[model samples]
Target chain A: MCQLLGMNSKNPADIGFSFAGFRARGGLTDDHVDGFGIAYFEPTGLRLYCDNRAAMDSPLAELVSQTRVKADNTIVHIRKSDDQLLSNAHPFTREIWGEAWVFSHNGKMTIKDAADSDPIKQGKSRHYCPVGDTDSEFAFCYLLNQLKEQFEYKPDARTLYEFLTVQCRFLANYGLFNCLMSNGEWMLGYANTLLFHVTRQTPFGSAALIDVDVTMDFETVNETDDVMTVLATTPLTSDEDWQQLAVDECIIFAEGHMVYQDVPTRPVYLSIEEGLKIAKNA
Target chain B: MCQLLGMNSKNPADIGFSFAGFRARGGLTDDHVDGFGIAYFEPTGLRLYCDNRAAMDSPLAELVSQTRVKADNTIVHIRKSDDQLLSNAHPFTREIWGEAWVFSHNGKMTIKDAADSDPIKQGKSRHYCPVGDTDSEFAFCYLLNQLKEQFEYKPDARTLYEFLTVQCRFLANYGLFNCLMSNGEWMLGYANTLLFHVTRQTPFGSAALIDVDVTMDFETVNETDDVMTVLATTPLTSDEDWQQLAVDECIIFAEGHMVYQDVPTRPVYLSIEEGLKIAKNA
Candidate 1:
């Protein structure tokens, strides 16, 4: 179990207020002291910070509070790995699609070994490859590789949306593969076990971290109409409304506002090429 | 041992050709293959991909080569660990001063235990918090912490320029800590044990990766100046005029060019706060 925090806004913004409370639940006040990380997308670059240490103890968390390294998009994670999961599956790792991709998850997943499920015959494989033996990270790489093989490097935005929805549905069947991803532009949130979100705009209100007493007056944080969406394994605030994510559901939030909502039907395993056909047909 | 590939250009460009050659050196054609990572500063944010596996075998590396993730600034490294540094002390990590800072390094480092060198209770205690347990990484956090303690946040470029040179000089004495750092605007490179660089611009010649034969005519590149600097633990190419760094010296490169150089009389041993004072004084 882990907690995830994300924000997408029209204008660059820091997630210190909401992250403050979310981090407490990971450890400190709560018991999530496994590891923590934060990613901020700046102009043509990113400020990504991670620590095998807890968020509360992370030098990054402290810096996030004091300094505003604003970004239009951001995702944060507080990991809680029980003995059931392998330590190798920690929320940070690199995945390959048509481009270098980064992924972090906040749930448990049991991925299949390709050798057992689908053995490679000779030198013939244009699909996914798993470098690490972790399930969650494997799922991320597998999903992305599927997308890559199907689209062959370029997929329209609409096609990407449908493909991702299908992939999310597929992941939901295997325990919690709840995830968040960014090519560093838009923030994608998928939930199976538990997750919540709140988007702030005009006439915003102050919110408190559920685990911590820290609160910030959103009204005083500039009068601009900025939309910020927050995601977590559980609600970080006692007072705010955190919409529970149904299995096979995903939401695309960009520039701090929700843009796409996907409630998938059922997940059926498909070949990488087959998945692309679905995208092309859709 | 590591291989670092960096590109700085007036316009965003795809680093596929150079990366292809550089990636091959990672435990394939040559040896430095313990881990590898590459980061791209796209038009809006950073797209980073890394793996603790051999770059030659990484699907992530293959994707990076096939898909052109164009960017203005990029850094890639293939690792062969000599110090047995843990992942926490690995080349990729973020440290903060005011703006978000990114750092990566090549080569081994001789880290002195503060407890070993500095007499305990022999003087008033100084405050220093290490974020990780590697000498290379410790130097990164220590430099930033020192700078932050003095300036708090947001210091000028000149101050930063001077401070980094002195700090690099100190860092170089502790064995091989050759490094590269960027704040998404300007880049700084310090050559300690062995690091080489090449800045390409108009009338550029055909440059090829030493590890692989992938080559491109810089003349065809769409940049006012195709300024690129390649730094590595060992010389990657035989043809290029690689500069051998002077022992115990630091060199500053900004905006595709070199601006300052420093050769310290002796290692500057000062408190974190005192070091920041130099940046402030500058």
Candidate 2:
């Protein structure tokens, strides 16, 4: 399994504080260190930084932490690769309709099985293809292909939210599918297992990091109108109220607010024996 | 007009020395600083760093100068944007046949006129499209599209060179067309106006930058077996014997050696009056 961190803000804000704690999960606090990547959506283009080196030790990541680079939308991933090639690094990006769409995944899914059912493999994804050999990239390409096939051009936000929720649920059925995706404007987060999020606004306070000996006073840095929402596979802060998402849920956030969410409507119970078999196979 | 710098080496090598001088052209030594970008091809993937800020002032560029990140192939550009959007920054990248193709251009051409004749604008470029509005990007899309239509997948290097030379000559007829392109394994450079390159081998010596007061002792840093070829809009070093490319010349470099070169077969003479009219119209 890997780790993910995403931020969406009404005003551009730096992720240095949370990234410091989250990057520790790459090797220091916990062991998911195969590679790491981060994507920051600038006003007119995207800046992507990725390395096969452990984030805990990467000089580039250190520079990122030291510099207060701000962005309205950002996504970061620390990977423990099932596919150990450098090409398998997270936060893969593809261009669509003149905008860069970025995606990162946190859990494993069976590649052969997913590709067998992917629309991209069925000959619909003529324009975009993955340059890496990871199941995560395959799934991302499939998702983009689906979107391209469904819409003639960029669709409205509500329509996109409705379509993507169903797609995420379908992907979750195959295996663990926690993911975060963005296209500069909005962030879409989906959870099959573990995900947590926190929205900070006017009543900002000091927060302590869970993985490092660090604390930040948000009140000192943020303005009254500043709204920022951060999502992660695990909570990075110890003192903040982070809401844990239920399984098989998809949420959309824009301008630091939850614009849309889809919760599981019907609960399906599985036998313990069946769950054990699924876990064993995975 | 913008500036382009490219490096192709036998072994993975850091471009910090040449980059320091080239970056000076971004604002300090010259005034081409609207934006800047660099793309480094790692063993299995590509790392792209770009910023709309002036390279002389960008902290990211400063960090790049400090870090010794190495690659076998690298391309850098400092721009005075005809279209001042971050998306219009040089060194744009697109993926084809599971390989990332990077390109940067250093001249201006009429946009609407070029688009009218571009295959991409004619709707035949189904596989690749420009995400940015610059004429350079449109030409890149057209080039990639023509390549795709001619070859089903990645073509042999020599075949690609032969095809690209003809295509570039066609583009140059419209206006100035100087560019550098790479797909990790090889680099292709085309010059319609000004471009220079130097290949360094065993008996390396200290060289001073033309744009900065810095000097590098290649003997101290490089192995005897190391070979590197650096190409730029102009000579980056003061003492090196850089070879200037003739008009309508295209060269291919791989593993630090020039594998192919094409020079114009016949030169067309134009009257001074006609030349002035063309320049004025452009």
Candidate 3:
């Protein structure tokens, strides 16, 4: 199992506060420290930094934490891969329709490369191939391949949301498939077992971190009309309310607001602790 | 009218010394202060950093200079675009055949997006498209599209060199089109107007930077078996004997040694100053 932290803001915002607390889980408060990566979507380009080292110890991570680069959308991951290779680091990116798409996975999937010969897996490696050997990257490529095969150009936000909901549900059948994806314009989060999100708007109050000795007053950081949404595998703050997504649920947030959501019928709820145990045993 | 710096080494080597000199051109030394970027190829992946700010003023570039991340292959660029946008910053990266390809250009081209309808420009935007409006990126997409159309997978280095030599010459017909490209394993440099290179091996001596006051003793930094080749739009070190590539020349370097070189018949020789004037007027 890994850890994920995603942020989407109506305007460019700094993620240092949320990231400071979340990065503590990468071998400081909890152990998910095979590697770590973060992607910050600048106005027109993306800045990606990945290190095959514990986020708590990596100098690159320290640089990222210290340098407050304002971005519209950001994705961070602390990996727990069996093989500590740089290629397996999360927050993989691919360019589609002249836009860069970033993806990160938190849970293990039972899908194997040998099954790529199946009809469903065809063209997965043809249009977009995984540079790494991780099942997460393989799955990301499959998703992009499907999108490319269906559309010659980038589709509208609503169309993409509808397509992604069904595709994400299908992927969850493979196993625990918690993921976060973004193209800078919108963030899509899917939870098979455990994922939580919180939105902060005007009249915001202070929030205390769960893992670190830090408190931030959102009122001071955000402007009058600012809105932002943050998603994580687990809640990073102790005071604010964080809503857990239902199993097999897919949600899309754009401009700091939830635009679409789909919840499967007869969803099976699972606790974070239970999910961690199963992930460890796998 | 940009600046380029590239390195290929037999062993992972620190490029801080050369980068310090090259970065000065972004603001302190010469006026190419539109944007800057650098790509470092790690053992299994790549780390890319780009900033729209002048390299001398960018904190990110300062961090990059302070943190000496060793890499086997590296590419850096300081831009001078009319529109100083982050998207126009080089070096640009694209994934081809599951390998990340990095490219940076220092010259102007007359190629326009309207030319996509031409037979020679077929699939240029379909297979790969430029996110920015720069002619340099458009040319890069065209190059990659041509390579993809011809080869299903990454071809051998020799075959790629031969194919690229022809393609680069064809692109030069549009205008000055000097560029450097790499896929981590090898580096391909083409000089339509101006380019220079220097190689350092055992028994290396000290060299002084032309832009900065720093000097480095290569013998103290490199091992006996280590070899490195540095390529740039202009000679960076004052004391080293740099070799200038002839116009319409294409060269490939791997493991710090030149693997292939092609010089066209009746090649026109242009000085670096002359090339810069032509680029600025473009």
Measured by TM-score, the strongest candidate is: 3
lDDT of 1 at A7: 74
Ranking by DockQ: 3, 2, 1
User: lDDT by residue for model 3 over A65-174, one digit each (tens)?
Assistant: 88888889999999987788887888898888988899999888877834766644678657788888887988888898889888898888789898988778777777
Give each model a TM-score. Answer: 0.49, 0.90, 0.97
**Candidate 2 colliding pairs:** none
> In model 3, which runs have C-alpha deviations exceeding 4 angstroms?
B113-116
Predicted structure with the largest lDDT when compared to the true one: 3
The CAPRI-style docking tier of model 3 reads medium
How many pairs collide in each candidate, listed in order? 14, 0, 0
The CA root-mean-square deviation of candidate 3, after full C-alpha superposition on the true structure, stands at 1.6
As for candidate 1, its interface RMSD to one decimal place is 18.5
lDDT of 2 by residue, B36-124 (tens): 88899877778887778788987778978998988999999998865557778878988777678899997877655645565436753
Error of 2 at B200 (Å): 1.4
Predicted candidate 2 versus true structure: per-residue lDDT over A164-195, tens digit per residue? 98878777765778899999999999977777
